[model samples]
Target: MKRTGKRIISMLLCVLLASALSTTALAAEDGKVLKLAFTDSPTLVIGDMTIYHPSYAAMLAFKGAFEKSTGGEYSVELYPNGVLGDAASTMEQMLTGTITGSTPADGALSAFAPDIQVFTIPYLFDNPTIAYDVLDGDFGRQLFEKIAAETGFRVVASYDNGGYRNFTNSKREIRTAADMEGLNIRVQDSPVYLEMVEALGASATPVAFLELYSALQTGVVDGQENSCVTTLGASLDEVQPYCTLDGHLLGLAFLVISDTWYQGLDADTQAKVDEAGREATIAARGICRYAEALAVDTMVANGVQVYSPTAEELETF
Candidate 1:
């Protein structure tokens, strides 16, 4: 009886330790390993290899640069496939310095800086070029600063989450917003996404990401919108038969480090971290292009009909 009681207490302690986001103690106890976490999908592909997610590709690039720049002082350990938790949970860990950094989508980042909604506005930029130029320029830098000020995160980069969100539905091919009348669209459980769908003349239905496939299959929603990287990741192409390249929202993801954790680093180390992050950002674009191509190809192969809407046509939506 006494031994069983001790074993039970030990198990409880282990559970508590895992639940706690106490990175300082962890860093000190486990050597100089930095931890990072993100969702499972084509991004990390359930922690498997594929490298189809831009953020994951950036993470891979950052790993090597970080090791080289840090002079072998710190090594990164990843908890991919949402093993650590969802974007929101991981962001909490990062902010608390329980983890080193993260690259959640702009929607997730909005939880930190609500102004991020500005980027999510439909048709904000004409193309990826314009989006990159603006985000890689002063406007992007200033916004990152604002994010740091408002939230306790030192945002390092805004890597392309790849391509723009397009319209996908099992119902019919959508060429313009006018075609969206009365369609039921699944959106993220957020006000901004709800607004976007509503603006397109569709009723917005909020559903959890993990349950989206079942929702679409069950007729809970008629359509959805997302980047190719994610559309492929969720295997939505298997269920949704039609796609229109509306290019509505430019998929932007932010890489953020804990402000307090960053401040604690030596000046040299901090510079190296920033350098690695920048390198990751630059490396990600090419990777994003490839992943997007592959995703589109995959969808087409799977029998999803894709349409490209003209700028004037999209404006009607």
Candidate 2:
């Protein structure tokens, strides 16, 4: 009887210890792994410079570095190429805690942060370098921090997309806004883009990026606006002929995460994660600028009717 009672006590103790260990693991007092979903298109093809594309492989570099640096305790689950949904949907998901993070263009994020939309306004910056200083400086940080406090989203880094340049399949070179009359320009589904295209006198059509090439080929739209990198990265040269260096607006992207999911992490882990994201953002931006320069040179060499408007020609807009 004594032996049996001792055996039963040992079994009960083992069970209790196991349950306690399980609870501790679940609580993750030390640290936890993080999964972040980004906006991207599923069928978007990759290129030699795809790694430098802000929304694609460049993000992967961020994810890898964060995971490796943290010794696997912290990690990201990147949903590239819109596997999660469009930029808007992805942002919504992050807000609801269904997703941990996202990278959306400033114009796309304007619906959430109106101040960010200001960057998309016409003639916002003379060039990418000036834009970068504004974004990485104290004013940008304060603005982003305010956005986070007000909107329950955290902006870790500001990413750079290529300059918002214009392109067309039509034969005429657009030297002035008057030349844009009656042109059906395909634009990303952003109100800022729509407004700007309207200002330039084109009938702007909102279309997803993947469908743009086919749209231009079949006359669904007569032209579009994007950076040199996107024009080449997407192989748009196959369809669009007249590439214009309008430099209409500066483009900016952000690596954002849900405040709720982020707050759930311990402070130390969160700091490391934030630092990693910042590094990734800087790296992605640099990669984009380099890729854009190369894309422009390559496109010019490939018989693209590249147009540089004269100083007087640029004033019509």
Best by lDDT: 1
Tens-digit lDDT track for model 2 on 1-317?
99999999999999999976665465355435454666554222234433445655446766777777766555466677677788898888878777777888877687898888767777777678788788879988889888888887788878667556655555567777898988999988777788889888889999898888888888989888888877876778877778888788767888887777767777886887678777877777777676677777777777788887887877777
Q: Best-fitting candidate, measured by TM-score? A: 1
Q: How would you encode candidate 1's per-residue C-alpha lDDT over 1-317 as one tens digit per residue?
A: 99999999999999877754464355457556778776854342311336656777677778889977765567777677898899999999887678888878887888778887788777888877788888779998898878787788877767668777888998988988889999999988878789988987899999888999999999999989898768877888888999988887887887677777777888988899889888878777777777677777767877889888877887797
What's the TM-score of each model vs. the native?
Answer: 0.82, 0.77
TM-score, model 2 to reference:
0.77
Q: Flag regions of model 2 displaced more than 4 Å.
A: 1-31, 41-52, 68-71, 188-191, 205-211, 264-270, 310-312
Candidate 2 clashing pairs, residues 3+ apart or interchain = 36-77, 40-81, 40-82, 41-81, 41-82
Error of 1 at 195 (Å): 2.3
